[model samples]
Target chain A: MRYLKLIKVFIKTSAQETLMYRANFWVSLLHAFLNLIVAVLALVILFGQTENLNGWNLSSTLSLLGVYLIVSAIRNLFIGPSLEALVGLGQEVWNGQFDFTLLRPVNTQFLITFRIWRLFSLIDLFLGGAVLLYSIFQTPQSPNLLAWLLFLLALVAGILILYAILLAFTALVFWNPGYLFTWVFDAIFQLARYPLGIYPVGVRIFLTWIIPVGVITTIPAQVISGQTGAPIVFLILAASVFLFLFASWLFNKGIKQYHSASS
Target chain B: MNHRGGFALIKATWFSWMQYRSFFFVLAFGWMIPPLVALFVWSAAAGEGSLGGFTRGEFITYYLVLVLVNQITYAQVNWTVGDIIREGTLNHWLLKPLSAIYQALSSELAGKVVYLIFVIPVGLLLAILLKPEIQTTPINFVLSLVATLFAWGLRFAWGFWLAILAFWITRADSFLALQDSLVFIFSGMVAPIPLLQGSLQQIANILPFRYMVGFPVEILVYDLSNKAILFGFLMQLTWLAIAVLLSRTLWVKGIRHYSAVGG
Candidate 1:
């Protein structure tokens, strides 16, 4: 309840800040539009050659693209903006202003994560949603209620996994203040844009198990698109849980390390 | 304009880049994966059958070659130019004895050298592992080198001009990002130019973006007719000229428009 109140305050503050810059809205919309065009054009060109790629037709690929866009937008909207403020600038951490954040009567992670919200990030979500709906319509398979449920679950799991990776990277900032790992994460996100079935066997295994980029958007997209089963959902959910726990543990350890380093 | 000063700057930047070698490697790894994914997808799509006149081996060669070409031609300094101008750092650059282009060139050269240190070894490794069919002629190889150099120069000039617009529009970064998306679609990064449909291929042919990354790859991977090669060279020179002129115009106009505000 307290965090909810805090998030509300943050959202209100963000809304005011966003409103002050109306140009951001247009720029963000154009960015999403440009991204959509590129993704769609690529799909069109790829499908022009042959029909199905590892049972992924143009529609399935479009859905995958949609998921990729939405997931990336989610990162931009909340996790990226906030984590960047924390670890990227290192303004608070490097200059020891993060001391003030620690002294605050709130959960530091929660405070950091929820404090910044880019409302313009919704433009990508909206665009992604449109693409998803259109692609779903084009797809021959109409998934049942169970599949939809599983798809939503897998989506949540994917987002959690992403956050876990981000949190772990930010935790490392306590030790190495320079070099944002988020750039590395941004690069990895490109791999997740395509289905893992395309890569060689070695890469497939790495993306699926090591980084979980394979499962991030692709598995959820597959489940709902009728390409895979509900069992994959459980697998992803388990991975998400394990990753979250590990990331939180690492973050706590990093805080301890920070105190020791400063002392 | 001072060659000795430029060499010193370049050397300094190169050494500075060595400090952040790991970060660049991480970035290069991220960059390498997308083309790898495309390589696999196209190979799978071409499975035992040619797609758009490209054999499975040909698809592999195209992407592998593209990985090299794209890596070599990519100039991402425009992403920073907006920040430099917006923050009034461009003022300091203007006051420098040597040309500001030399400073930018220093960073550009340093980054490329740092990138290639990782990119080449990885390329050779992939060449051995993936066994992409090697196709080349002595003449085509020489032409590819020339085309690749021009591509880098053209892309950098265009992006730099776009970045200089920060004097007139604070949202110049947004447009630079949009230009990147255009390149992603048209530069044969996603698919070979021949794979695109009639109008799309035409657009790619007309646009300077194809010359930026795709044309060099095409020259190396496919046996183009003499006419095609001649047409490509013409396009490359024309675009390079236009980019230079546009950048010069923007540089002269933007300086008059830019002044440090309130600080």
Candidate 2:
């Protein structure tokens, strides 16, 4: 019940903070829309060059790009801002701000997780949906009910995995207060821009097992394109759950090391 | 021509970076990731062959050179300008004997010098390992040097003008972000402009984005015809002149409405 109240407070604070900057809100929305347009132009250029690139047709590639953009957008909406905030939190903790957070009758991890949200990032969600729908309309092959269900399932799992990864990276601040790991995390995600098939087998293996960026977008794309089976879906789900649990454990361990500036 | 004050300021900025050497390294490493990833992807696509008339070695050389050129030409003036406007820091600059732009330009140059230690060695190492197809002609080298200087001036002026837009809008970061996204697409960060489709390629050529990085990098890596090289240099100078005139006009006008907001 306390956790529910904490979430409510976080949402309220975030909304209020966003409302404070009306100009910023509109500017960020326009920025996101421009990014979406650029992505569309890129797709058009890619298809214009050839009907198929490396055996992936225009529609399939567009579907993959759509999934990539949506996953990336969702990550930016939630995890991205949180990660940046975590860096600031790391600095603040080093300078004794953790004491303030600890004094509150709220879970520290939960407080840190949802402290800030760039509400304007919802533009990416709308843009991604539009692109996906446009691509589906143009495609001859239609995904059935099962495909849709599995794709949504994989997507949720992917989001969980991404959240876990971000949490784990944030928790690293306990050990290395410098917040240098953010760059590494960003670089790992950059690999997801292309379909996993374009990468070598070794890279694909590393991304799947080590970084799990592949699950963030590729698995969902595969499901939507009807390329994967139940086993792969099960694997992704299992990994997502494992990662979340592991990251939670790490966060708890890190919290114990927190030394309040007040003391 | 009493320039001692300006020289001292530039010297102080350079020395400050020396005191914080690790920060420069961290920033250069952060900046290198995107271009490095692009190099790998393009290399993989070329795959012991050629794509769009660019061999693997040529692509590697092009991007390696691009990294250095981009570092040298990058202007953070917009960010600084926006900060000054938002934080009321511009009042200090306005009171100083030197123009605000001189301070911004000096700091940017100092940053470039600091970044060189990290960038140059890595660039040379990559060039040696990858063996990028570069034309080693005296005239080409001279032209590259000239193009880089012009590019720096053009980018700095352009960024300064964009920063001046903060006088009109509080949220200028969004516009800067949009400029960066355009740079990534049109400045040959993803791929060569020539490799893009007919209309996209034309658009890239018509814009100053290509002159900012691609033109110099291309001149270094490939044997451009005399006509093309001449036209490219002319275009760079033309853009630089336009940007300088616009920035000068905007700065004069922006200061009139500059009601410093916060500190």
Candidate 3:
């Protein structure tokens, strides 16, 4: 309840900043729209030359694209922006500004994550929904309510894994406090856009185990489209649970290791 | 100003880039992976048959060459220019004896050189593993290099002008992001021009984006007629001229606006 109140205050403070730069919202929206168009065009050209990709047709691929877009939009909307601020705590530590943050009454993680917000990033969520619906329309097998529930379940699991993976990356900053380590993570996430089946076996292993984007994107699509069994979704849910706990523990440990600039 | 000065700036830039060699190595891999993923996808889609005149091996060759072309021509000038304007660091460049364009060019050339150090080794490994079909003549190789130089020039200038928009607008980086979307769409990053249907193909033919990266890759991978290669060069030159004009105009106007209001 306290955290909720804190976040409400944070949002109210951020709303003014977001409103001042209204052009940014439109620009970001256009950018997202254009990126989706390119992605669709790529699929169109691929399907033009051949009907199916490893037994996946245009509609199936479009659905996969939709999941990628929506998942990323959700990340940008809250998870990504919030955790990015957590990563910036390393800079604060280096500059001796972290002591002030740490002295706050609230949880350090909560304060770190909720300090700033970019409401403009939410534009991607709408566009992602549109693309998802467009693909759902194109698909011959329309998902039932139960299927959507399953898809949403898998999506939550996928999103949790993404957040966990990204959180672990940010934790490294507390130890290093110099290089922008998040950029290395940035290099890998774009790979999440494609289905893992397209990659070779070795890469498939890496994406599944290390980054986990393969599971994050593919399992959701596979479940939603009825391409795979329900058992797979259960497996992913279990893995996501484990990853979330592991990442949180790692982040706390890293925070403990942080020696402030003043010290 | 002089040969020694220019060479010294290039040398300094190259050595500075070497400081982040490890980062560039990872980043080069990141840049290379998307094209490789596309190759795998297209090759899988092709299966036993050709798609849009690209056999599986041909698709492999096209994407592999594209990896090289895209890396060389990729300009991060917009980010730099945006930073310079936003931070009011243009004063430093204005005080310098050399033009800002030369500084941008120096950094760009150094980045390419540093990036290629990793990219060439990776390219060789990919070539050996994938065993791409190459239809390169000595003449075509030389012409491709010339075309690539023009392509880089055109891209660099295009980004430089876009960056100058930061002087007029609060968030010019969004425009660059938008331009990146168009470049991805029309520059044949997503698909070959032949694969682009109807109006899209015509847009690619006329747009500056295609010449920035794709035209050179097409020359490298495809057996084009002499007339076709010549026409591509003409288009590249035309775009270069326009980009140059745009950059010069923007730089002059942006400087006047900055000076008038900066105080």
Candidate 4:
């Protein structure tokens, strides 16, 4: 109950801070919208040139693109901004200002994570939803109800997987107070632009097992396209849970190594 | 005197970058992926043959050269500008004896010098391993060098103009991100300009974006007639001139309205 109260306060504070800069809010919305348009146009151009790139047809590719945008939007709206804030917290800790955060009765992680909600990323989520729906409408064959349900489940799993990955990356801040890990994360995320099957077998396996970027968008996309089965979905869900737990463990471990600059 | 000052600034920046040896090495490793991935995809598409007029060897050469060209021409001043505006660090620079633009240019040059330590070795390894169909003509090489320098100037000026928008908008980072996405598509980062369809191809040809990465890379990989090469150089110069004018106007106007709100 205390945690819930703290979360509510954090959310309210973030919303107020976000509203203080109205021009930034509008520009960020317009920027996200333009990004969505560009993604859609690129897909349209690609599909126009070839009915099937590699083995996947237009509808399947579009569906994959939808998943990519949705996953990216969610990351941007919540995880991305939160991770950035966490990094700032790390920086503050490095510079001896963490005492202010520590003095508060609230959970430090929760406070740091929810401190600055980027309201503009919500625009990205909305645009992503619109694109996903539009792509669904354009597809000649509708996915069954079960498939849609599975897609949602897979998306949840994907988000968990992404969160786990980010948490692990952010944990590095305890050791190195800079943007190194963030850049690596960005590099991995760039791979989500295309279906994983197009990559070499080694890369495909590495993305799935090591970085897990493939699972964030591709595996769920495969499930939605009806290219995979129950076993893969189960494996993905289990992996997501395992990874999250592992990341949590790592975070706790890294915190013990944290030497506050104030000390 | 102005030209000499500019040259000195560039040289100073280069030397400063050498001081942060470890950071530059890490950054170079981070940046190597995009071009490497592009080369991998293009190679796969070409297989044992050719695709869209580019053989496997030609694709390798084009992408590797592109990696170098992109490194040399990248304008990270946009990122710095956004950061300075957000953090109110611009005030410190404004108070300095040197122009903030010169400082930015110097810092950028320093980074480039440091980055070359990594870029050069990896680029050479890829070139030798792949044995790409590279053009060794003196005229093409000389033109490419000239075009690349002009392209860097144009991109830096354009990015500086965009960054100055932070004076009016806090979340100008979103616009920069959008610009990056557009450049990825239009600047032949993913695929060559010739591979794109009719209208898109024309847009890529006419836009300054192509000159930033593709034009110089094209000069390296293919033999263009003197007339074509001259026209490309002219286009690059024209865009650079426009960017300089835009940045000058924007900077003057933005500083006039610069109400430093936060530190």
Query: How many pairs of residues collide in each model?
Result: 0, 0, 0, 0
Candidate achieving the largest lDDT: 1
Residues B117-220 of candidate 4: C-alpha lDDT, one tens digit per residue: 78899789867767887657887788788888888998999899999899888678887887888787888886777788888888887888988889988887
lDDT of 1: 0.86
Q: Sort by DockQ, best first: what order?
A: 1, 3, 2, 4
Error of 3 at A212 (Å): 0.4
User: Number of the top candidate by DockQ?
Assistant: 1
Summarize candidate 3's per-residue lDDT along A120-204 as a digit string, tens digits.
Answer: 6567777777877898898777989988988998999999998889878877878776655566666667777778887767778
Write model 3 residue lDDT over B1-263, tens digit each, in one string: 55567678889999999998987777777777767777778777777788877788898889888998889988877788788788887787777788677788788889899999999888889889888887788888888888888888889888888988999987888888889888877898878777888898998999999999889888888888889888888989998999989999988988888852354
State the lDDT at B58 in candidate 1: 93
Q: Provide the global lDDT of candidate 3 against the true structure.
A: 0.82
For candidate 3, please provide the TM-score of chain A on its own.
0.93
Model 2, C-alpha of A178: deviation from truth (Å): 3.1
Q: Rank the candidate models, highest TM-score first.
A: 1, 3, 2, 4
Q: Is candidate 3 or candidate 4 better by lDDT?
A: 3
The candidate with the higher lDDT, 1 or 4, is 1
Better of 1 and 3 by lDDT: 1
Once superposed on the true structure, which residue ranges of model 4 sit more than 4 Å away at CA?
A: A1-6, A88-92, A96-116, B2-12, B21-41, B47-49, B81-101, B125-136, B161-181, B223-227, B245-263
Candidate 1 residue lDDT tens string, A134-196: 998896668788888988998899999999988889998898776667887777778887888
- State residue A217's C-alpha deviation in candidate 4, in Å: 0.7
